[model samples]
Target: MLKTYSVSLAVGILAGLIYAVLDVNSPAPPIIALVGLLGMQIGEHLIPLVKRLINRQPVNLHWFRHDYHHKIGDNPPPSGDKTS
Candidate 1:
C-alpha cells in the first residue's frame, strides 16, 4: 500500500512538473478529477461483480472480506486478527 501511494504521488508530481514546463493547464479541476478517479475505482469492480452475479455465485460479507475487497485494496488483516 505504501508503494502504491508513493508511486501515485510520484507520478502526480511528475505530471504537475510536465504541465508547468509545457504551460498546459490540467483538463479538469481537482475535484472533478478526483470524482473521475473514484468512478474509475468503482468501475474496476463492476464487471467482475456482474459476472459473479450472472453465474449465481454467493455475495456476502465473508465473500467480500475474503475475496472482493483484497482485489481492490491492500492486503487483508492477518488471520489471527479477529477484529476484521
Candidate 2:
C-alpha cells in the first residue's frame, strides 16, 4: 500500500511539473479532482460488485470487507480464493 501510494504521488508530482512547464491549467480544482478520484475508486468496485450480482453470487458484508482489503493490498484473501 505504501509503495502504491508512493508511486501515485511520484506520478502526480511529475505531471504537475509537466503542467507547470507547459503553463497549462489544471482541468479541475483540488477538491473536485479529489472527488473525481473518489468516484473512480467507487467505480472500480462497482463493476465487480454488479458482476457478482449478475452472476447470482452472494453480496454481503463479509464480501465487502474482503474486497476492501484485497483492493488495498492489506490483509489480502488467501491465494486459493477467487475474491481478488
C-alpha lDDT of all candidate models, in order = 0.76, 0.76
Best by TM-score: 1
TM-score of each: 0.56, 0.51
Q: In candidate 2, which residue pairs clash?
A: none
lDDT of 2 at 69: 56
Mark the 10 consecutive residues where model 1 has the least summed lDDT.
Answer: 75-84
CA deviation > 4 Å runs, candidate 1: 1-25, 80-84
Point out where model 2 deviates above 4 Å.
1-24, 77-84
Candidate 2 lDDT score relative to the true structure: 0.76
Clashes of each: 0, 0
* Model 2 weakest lDDT span, ten residues long: 65-74
Clashes of 1: 0
